[model samples]
Target: MIKIPGEKLIWMYKTMLKIRHFEDKIHRLFLEGNMPGTIHLYQGQEAVAAGVCANLERSDVITSTHRPHGHALAKGVAIKSLMAELFARSTGCCGGKGGSMHVGDPDVGMIPAIAIVGGGIPVATGIALAFKFQKSKRVAVSFFGDGACNEGSFHESLNMGAIWNLPVIYVCENNLYGASTSIRVAVKIRDLAERASSYGIPGVVVDGNEAISVYQATSKAVERARGGQGPTLIECKTYRRGGHSRSDACNYRDKEEEKMWLTRDPVVILRERLTKDGILTPEDSKQMEKEIEEELTQAIHFAENSPWPKPEEALEQVWA
Candidate 1:
């Protein structure tokens, strides 16, 4: 397992807590008619984003999915701006254009997240291509779900990355279900990482709920990419605790499956690990959660009071 420094571990905890609370608030806000747009909460898969991003530098890039709040927070997007963006205000991360699915700040090394399932896979490849042409060592990581593996872009991106040896890491957060469909019904292969070998790249499977394991796997992939070796595919075994989107009921998931995942809650596991390793006390963890909740409350107020973008503003950013 990769050993993170005290400061970094604390940062990870803070980020994860922020995502949890922020999404929880968004859910409430949407239900109460205070917020617009549909949301796909990142309630359970916090460790996957945190661990993968921990190995990335500020200049390094990453792509996110429709459920990208965790990646946005982990990649250093400011919470206030993210909340503002969700509110469709001018002060938002995208001037209110990107909204929930596209929340990102390139200034912080995160490109606006690609909402399309596997769209960002090739985009990440392009970013790595740019880095390679410039002889720079920045790595580009792509975050996609298990469903994206079946997309043509996934295959194309892997083939190109392997042939050119682009500095990219494909992270598949195999959360068991893609939208409302289970992976069992979608594909025959149980391990998405195995697809990596078809492109002549290394594929690793990691315990996505365990932050340490995810961090360690990502570290090696990042290093190999920096050393001009090539891309790698990391399939993180995890489960999404919520529906694919606010509209989803997840009627397809069995009660037993949900119960099994709840038992492996990422946040609970992290707290337990930190306490056991002597890196943090239970009290310290509680304090962190408290602080994050307070900050999120502030973000909610900021978004609430912020003015919406003027109607005429649509003509400004467009290139028509």
Candidate 2:
């Protein structure tokens, strides 16, 4: 276990809570028909983004998948701008161009998310190539789901990354199901990290629910990549407690399985550990939650009051 400082742990806790509350609010907004566009919520897998991003610098860039808000938040994107993006306001990070699935901010080093499955793999690889050519220590991270592993781009990008020793970290946020389909039905092998061996790169499997473990694994990977060693494939074993999309009811999931992952809720797990280890008291946790609620409230208010993009300006940001 990486011995994270008490203050850092609390900050991680806050990030996880922020992600949870953000998703919770989004879910309600979608249900109430106030929000436009569909969302792939990142409720239960907050720790993966929180932990991995904690190891990255602002100069480090990350390309996110369709389910990207957690990564955006963890990478230091402003909540107000993110909420505005979700609400389709012109004051958004992408000027209201990239909606829910495409939420991100260049100022924060998170590229506009690629909603297509496995699409960001090549883009991230290109970024690594850029970093290498510039001889910069900066790294690029690709955040994808289990489903992307099956894509051809995953293998090609990994092979190229390995051969060139690019400073790229491929993070697989395995939340059991790739949308509504389970991983078992997709890949015969159990451990997604094992695929790294074929590409001659280091692969690691970590408890995505445990922030410390994730931090340790990513820290090592980042160090190696910065040294011009190579890329790393970190598959974080996690589970999402909700449906894959806005309309999914998760009827395909087993009740017992859902219960198991719910018990392993990253936020709750970290909160318990923080309190039990004498790092935080119950009161302290509650205070943190209270603060996060205020932040969420303000973000939502900002989004609601933000301006919308003009109809004619839509084509301005688009490529001709």
Candidate 3:
């Protein structure tokens, strides 16, 4: 385990808690028909988002995939705005336009999530190019699934980023399966980070369930990026506890595999580590959970009380 400040450790735990609780609430809302659209929950992969974003500056930007709530929250997006967006209320970050899959707040450095498998790759590369053009130290991160590794955009963007030495970090949250298709069946290589060598950039694989481990890997990658060394491909070996989407029952997954990953749940692992380290106590953990619940309640109330966007406003932000 890398040495981390007690405060940072606590923050990571809290962030993971928030993501878990938020996803749990969203799951219930979707099941009860309270939410407007389909959602790809981010239940088990909280550590990846918390650790990676913790190493970034406020000016640094990130592009997320369908599973973006964790990324949005980790990047400092307001909980109220996210809840409003999910509820399809006018006060949402996107004026209730972007539903579950498209949640983001650019003011907080997150681009509205692109639902396409590898869609955000090129966009993040472009953002990194802009940063280089402006001679800024800012970095752009693209968070994608292992399925995107096979996409042409992923290859092209990596090639461009490598050749131009753009300050970018490509984070592959390899959650064992990409929408029910196991990585074993999808790719030949065991480690996705190995693909980075083709672009002549550094490749790293880390235990994504361990927040400190992820933070360490991201810290090194960010330092290299800020120093103008070019891009890095970091493969985070993690797992998603829930189905790919709300409708999926994950019947394709083996029961033992699910049980094994559940045992390594990132939130539970981190909380245990914190408690064992004396950085957090049982009472403190309970208090944190209570506070997160209260915050979620407030956000839900704000979303429910807010009015829906007028029909006329639908095409206002659309650009053709």
Point out where model 1 deviates above 4 Å.
none
lDDT (tens digit, per residue) of candidate 2 on 23-51? 99989999999988899999888999999
Model 3, poorest ten-residue lDDT window? 1-10
Worst 10 residues of 1 by lDDT: 9-18
Per-residue accuracy of model 1 over 227-250 as CA lDDT, tens digit each: 999999999999988888887878
The residue-level lDDT of candidate 1 at 277 comes to 79
lDDT of each: 0.90, 0.92, 0.94
lDDT tens per residue, model 3, 216-309: 9999999999999999999999999889999998999999988998999998898998988889999999999999999999999999999999
Root-mean-square deviation per candidate = 1.1, 1.1, 1.0
TM-scores, one per candidate: 0.97, 0.98, 0.98
- Per-residue lDDT of 260 in model 1: 94
Itemize residue pairs with steric clashes in candidate 1: none
